[model samples]
Target: MTRIVLALAQELAAIVAVGFAQRDEEVHQADPATVAAADLSGVDVLVVRSEPRVLNAALVAACDRAGVRIVPYATDAAGHRLAASFGLALLTTLEAEHIVHHTVPPHREPVCGGVIVVWGPHGAPGRSTLAASLAAECARGNRPTALIDADSHAPALAMMLGLTDDGPGFASACRAAERRTLDAAELSRVAQPLRATDGACSVLTGINRPGRWPELSAERVTACLEIARGWVETIVIDVAASLEEDGEILSDMASPARNAATIAALRSADHIVAVASADAVGIARFIRAYGELRALVGDTPVHVVVNRVRTASLGLDAKGQIRRTLARFTNVEEILFLSHEPDIADGAALHSRTITDIAPKSAFAAGVRRLAADVLGQPDTAATAMPRRARRGRKNKPAIADVAGVPAQLG
Candidate 1:
């Protein structure tokens, strides 16, 4: 008897389960949410609906890697084409009928890996820097990391890493994902590769123009990230702050999802790194949005990061004060405090390099490394501070306020 996992649309699932039960197959039904994560292990086959609620492309590819064949059900000829587009064998209507009547020894699922979405409330809370730095730091552990700029409102990874935004980028990747052709090789081709002294990462630059946000439709963005799980160990995404589903809910007609990219990233993430710009205004903005973010992620692990931690804003024991404020309002259990380092932020932007690449031993870099360690479940052996020579001109450095809320903007 073959072990089969069924992940289909709810109503369709019941019909299929009854039809496919009498066959010599051990069948188990999985929730759509569970299948979205692609956690298929010790299963021989995975049956799914064509163009499933989740990105079926990722599920199909993941199953292929596990030596499992996907038996996609398509009521019509178009459904078969959609399955074929994802590189799965075409299970024609007739073949699907045969499988329904009898058992077929084909199909499997995958062990999806880390997909971390770094997000924050608007006001330049260091989302881009944290995403880039986290990817770079995770890469230092010798795992292939991909840093994606999914911030439709303000795409900055291309500029921060000094990579060109001219060529095929994340938009191109999304198009391919929508077409169900975004395999590992295609993703590698579209993404610009960034190599640092200690590690390297693949970069998927965001849309060049803000108006081009429509290219990142929820299905496309979700599919792109889903297919991406097969490409690397760590996939770090920088997303916009807005979580409002206003565009989706307020209209009777199907409206364009303005914040779809951000929403999709949050929903697809295995872990979330929520950054806040450690200031009165920044904290207030975060507190207001915390509830909405919580509602969207639904039990996904969230790690709060208080960026630019300093006495200028919150006074003595700034970390403690901020912690109390957040505890009073939100459900943030553990907080990671990053020191205010304007010099490092400026120097990196001046050189168009990542923080670790420019000042690997800086306190800011150390904090990012720690965040990466926590996300990757690794040890935080990052250097505490830069060498004396590397810290030259410290006395002549500008005020932290002058460059506050700058890293996410610059790097």
Candidate 2:
């Protein structure tokens, strides 16, 4: 038998009589004040009146904590409309004039498609470079990918991918989300297609001005991501450096709005790629920022990408030393080292192209490809595979590293 509690006002007493008469159901009626303080143990469902103050976040949280499903009760048209807007199931008895069975919209779950968020600390840690490369690599592997430029302070994905930023991109999508119209069709229309050579990837450019960061709120960003998932196989988001929330903790009106996009991206990400430069200062900054990243993205898998890995920055055996240090000092277990190839990177940037399109055989490109493979959990045969003789001919091929401490060779 289903044990139900009717936490409704006295005006909606007819629901109690009808519910109690139903076979195989045990119903208990209580006043709104009593219901608020009552122990809801062993109750399968709690039916409450659809009042704004009574159906708030705090009440919802309480019901969730007590393991109860809340069903809103409404006898009047105004209350019914308000209940429907709150996404609640309205319950009415047979004695009511008409049974309005309003179908509640289902909660949207994160798509099966992979969501990889590339983030890093301040000081130009190559966050955009790594995010762009990862997205391009995924697309090159035949995965329909969407690269979101979510950097509120400095939006550079458009310039990096050679796409015009004048059009409606991420900001437009956020506005659509705010208006409750964001969906697969809207996402595809706003995301600009890139001129990638090997595979196709759509770019959702960021705000052209830094002042527009307030527009991309955490809720809106999350909505955009949910809509983008329906249209793509992989969603790669390039977030801002700082994860700090600027607001007064005591006042809701003074709450932080900046960095909302970055925080939302990290929170919603299936996997987070934390990129950090491979220099003394960069490493120090990354080490300090690592704790904060972990705190922000609790229990979410974070793969470390140490970019610009060169002997000049860190002497020989840089990978091994950095790996040991990260493992000992931080919670990082998987570390991918990307060597600095200024010529190749500069060429791609100069021509507004991806490294994969310009120099597919470069070590830095190869490292990024490996990182993409790790993120997707699949080997990128199309881009990473090379002819045996061609592979042998390259004398300066960076030593292929491992994933999760296992040694492996990169083709």
Q: Say which candidate scores most in TM-score.
A: 1
Local lDDT at 130 for model 1 = 78
- lDDT for position 327 in model 2: 78
Q: What is the model-wide C-alpha lDDT for candidate 1?
A: 0.75
Deviation of model 1 at 352, angstroms: 0.9
Measured by C-alpha RMSD in angstroms, how accurate is candidate 1?
10.5
lDDT of model 2 at position 300: 78
Model 1 — which ten-residue stretch has the worst lDDT? 399-408
| Index of the highest-lDDT prediction | 1
How far residue 188's Cα lies from its native spot in candidate 1, in Å, is: 0.6
Please count the clashing residue pairs in each candidate, in the order shown. 4, 0
State each model's CA lDDT, in order.
0.75, 0.73
